[model samples]
Target: MKLNKAFTLIFLSFYSFSKLLAQTDETYLFPINPGNKNYLAGTMGELRSSHFHAGIDIKTGGQEGLPVYATKRGYISRIKVSTSGYGNALYMLHPDGNTSVYAHLREFSDEIAKYVRAAQYENKTYEIELFPDPYEFAFQRGDVIAKSGNTGGSTGPHLHFEIRDEQQRVLNPLHYGFDEIKDNIAPIAQRLAVRPININSRVENRFDRKDYYLSRYGVNYAINDTITAFGKIGIELLGHDKLDGAANQNGISTIEVFVNDEKYHSQIIDVMSFSLMRDIIVHYPYDIKVNKGRTYHNLYVDNGNRLNFYESKANNGYLNIEADSTYHIEIKMYDPYGNISTVTLNIKGKAPAKQIKERIDFELDRISYQVEKNILKVFTRENCEEDANKELSIYINDSIKTVLPAYFLNNVAVYLWDLHEGIPTSVLSCNKGVNISINARAIPHQATVINAENFIVNFPQSALYDTIYVSTAYEVRTQDSLEVFSIEPVTVPLKSSFYVSASPQFSHYQKDKTHVYQTDDAGNFSFVGGSWSGETIQFNHRSMGEFTLVTDDTPPVIRPATEKNYYYISDNLSGIASYTASLNGEWIMMRYEPKLRLVWIEWPEGMQNKRGNFELKVKDNAGNETIYTTKL
Candidate 1:
């Protein structure tokens, strides 16, 4: 009775604490080491000129195998081991129903280590993913689970710790409890830009058509020659600030912009959802021709980007400033620990100078022109082309038809007008490049076929190794032969299977009389040219190799494998076997989640096992069926 009462009170206390966390106004707390002695290699919310940094990086004394302890008490939930990404990661579920993740570990504790090693051996693979039940491995406060290490995407040794909600949305660790970090440094404002109100427009340099440094505290620039503007205009400023103890210039966490005391935009890095990762591009500008480089400006407008951090009322988070309007702009920047920095700007607007117009033959049109390495690509949609004339000394290459995004550009990054438009979607140069590998995964509507007659390529530079686009294009044959030719790069061998499309429509018979099939638009293909017989058939690709195909024609070969010893009186359901298909002949890992009462399959990139029919022509050594299909 006493134990029951104690358990009830504990549950009630936890429930109340959870409610408080939900109701709190603070978004995140610090999760730093107890002492603020460590320096940062990367900072949360810092501008990368490309992708957004997802989590806070705490320095680990510049070495691996640093003892890492749980930030809070919780039960072991998920443990994933991989060569890339978080190296070896661990997840602990707290009493408050939240999960704390510790990634890139050098090793696990003895108890957990043994369990994982056994699992790895059973699976016969170095990489493994598993979810343990609530009581599988529980840890109290400061219980050591793993040691921090530099693994998978880490250039140095550091601890990658994150806190996530029930739905797996990663919240900023600074919100939980780390208040020890001191950041008194102010944010440095690099440059202020006045955007032209037209799309595809150009900002005239006071002297030349190129970008020039501004003399501090100077107002109004006079174009040395003629130029024109297009579309809406904004500013791209390059700036970063240092923390109190760390010398690295880290990204600011909070941004608040006010135009004459009116809130124009505000963004706080409280939490992020993984499902919204692609939204990272939408958070920055993508127009490579105008903004010049990939520096993200937070105007907090939702461009259908579920970034999970933006909270805005009007026009997303974009602060659309008008041309020829005098205004006062104030921007407030903050770090995770309430460290603040402010920048104030006073501006006066004027029309394009007459000399600027004469030099560039300035015309306001709807077309957007992007310049890369002296090469220019003009983009014009149905209603996009308008009269806009801007003369700039840029190299022009008319050979390439497509373009890469600015992130891949050399020494240059372009910022577009919209938020989340900053990812590298196109090649940054027009140099000749090699098509490294082929991805045959099937996608809707954009499937490529092998033996294509024409290939469409958008090379970013004249020198190879820039970025190469390899896709097969089709053309008609005069003799009705339906022959498809190769359009891939010159270096890609014409007969290489990577250039081959995996679509069933492009299937052909091999010498062995087996049919080869294409997988999808992504170049994932399959071949049933040979029989599965009793042994597992393996498929090989350039990078992905040696996958044993799980044949539905044969039932899953099951042995006397059960969870625990059961003294059942000869029940028919005693030891059931199962088998699943794998794409590109890879292994499909499966398990039945007792808590959810559902069968779960990991890394299933191909067809599924059929339902209900559990008998087949062949059987394993223990008399398991050769082809046994069962419901998931």
Candidate 2:
């Protein structure tokens, strides 16, 4: 690799910043920079695929081997190295009852590196974790602990740093006064949303949520439209934050909502618990995130959201608008530096019309239903003029469980069922039968077991944040050329995990080649390793989706090293399980990063043999292996 002059200058500046940190006396020095403006690639509370980001990411100028320093006098309490998730991480326990963490490291300091290698060799595994004695690997403030690199789940070269309280709650690193960082820019409001709480509620005279555009001028934002809403309504927002010297967007520090000059909602993301991190799914608009790829922080508490960071004065962060009343709405966002951006809008309440809506037109025999936030809304076609007040029946295992009166929405008869009571097997209305499709009800705070014809699922008591209406169907064939057990409504996600056991639908699949797979919307397969007991294979999974049982006899592909730096690249359809590298029939260390599908040699004890026989062995998750050999 080569670097332009500008890139070379930035690389030099990164090293200079590290050298400056080595002399700093600050109580909590920036891990990679001190006495200068520290750039960030990401911030605490940023939204991730599964949870909120636990820490801040310090930029390393697109280069590796930047020295990472200890922010406080502490001992290395824990160290971990793995192919995924914060590869090469170090945790230090300080005297002040707080823990500091540095992740995505290239290598530890000299003594720590030696210790990690000896333990890895002794354990005969590249990935390992160690808890040292209380006083081992102790260091003073500003002492180098490791060098930053792109490892683990990192997308680029940066250092992931964090601070945690004694209870393991992730605290915002910016809460500790670090002069190495400076930000004066206010967060920018991306979009504003208002939700109609119920059927009686309306936003802009429509019984649905509405999104409004925002305009900004420095620290102020405005919604140009005067929103017309009635009954109960709530607000949400999407936004990003900026720092002075970095061209990166980050998470806002705080979000507050005000109605009629009184504070209605407030949430400050200063600390987070890993145990409760999945509450992010409910804290934000999950549907909007899944559909639009935008994370909108709710200005009101959502159902099943159990986070403790929200504070409000009254009415649980909702506005009750009466007829002919005007309410001024304001949303304020704050960055860690106290920079403020205020968004303002106005709402006027109006009474709904008493006249019946225009008759809707739809196919007379169509019926469908989906669950949202534990409410099952069933839509069925109905006659427009002749007796629209029909009763819909709910059935459980071929028995009539209950009946619900019809409500008309868009000329369609609708039935609503609160799933907390129980899940129904099917719904009947207007001479049409709508199967609920769910196999069982997995409720929170209790273990649920379901043994169906094709598969058996064991739902742990902790597997659900709320009730899940479980549904599954078997398909004999699909594009994957395998037997599929489709789990309907993959839209609803589980906070924890559940175990699923199933016997192979086909007898031809051998136990060795047979593995369970979770399929995506596009029909791609991700290997879910399973253990067999007789003919049943069981696996633990955190998601509800289409599962397939098939034989994978393909081996991983090993790409030749494109660089002269002894790099080896490899990939597999079922995912790489493990790999090993040896030179001259002697074991040597190989660093593997799965994200890039690359593995590189790390010589032991500084061995520099000019000529040798080298072999790399790679294995796929399905037990297929590939070997590559070369003479150097």
Tens-place lDDT per residue, model 1, 322-364, is 4566556666767666656565665444443333223223342
Give the poorly placed runs of model 1, Cα more than 4 Å off.
1-36, 47-51, 192-231, 287-294, 298-304, 311-313, 317-324, 347-453, 456-632
lDDT of 2 by residue, 1-632 (tens): 99999777767755654554465354788889677778888898887767888889999999999889899877799999987889999999876768999999988999999898888777767899999865568798899999999889888999999999989899999978877888888998888998877656767665556888888776898888788888888898989898879988798878888888888889988899999888888788777777688888888887667899899787778788888999898888888888998999999898754323544344444678766655677776666355566677888665775544334555666666767666787887777787777778777889999877778889998878777778777777755567777665666667777888887667778778678888776878888889889888989887778888767788888777776535555554677888888778877778787777778776555575546898888888889889988886
The Cα local distance difference test for each model comes to 0.47, 0.80
Clashes by residue pair, model 2: none
Off by over 4 Å in 2: 1-26, 196-207, 224-234, 314-327, 347-365, 380-385, 388-415, 420-425, 428-430, 478-480, 559-569, 583-586, 610-614, 629-632
Index of the highest-lDDT prediction:
2
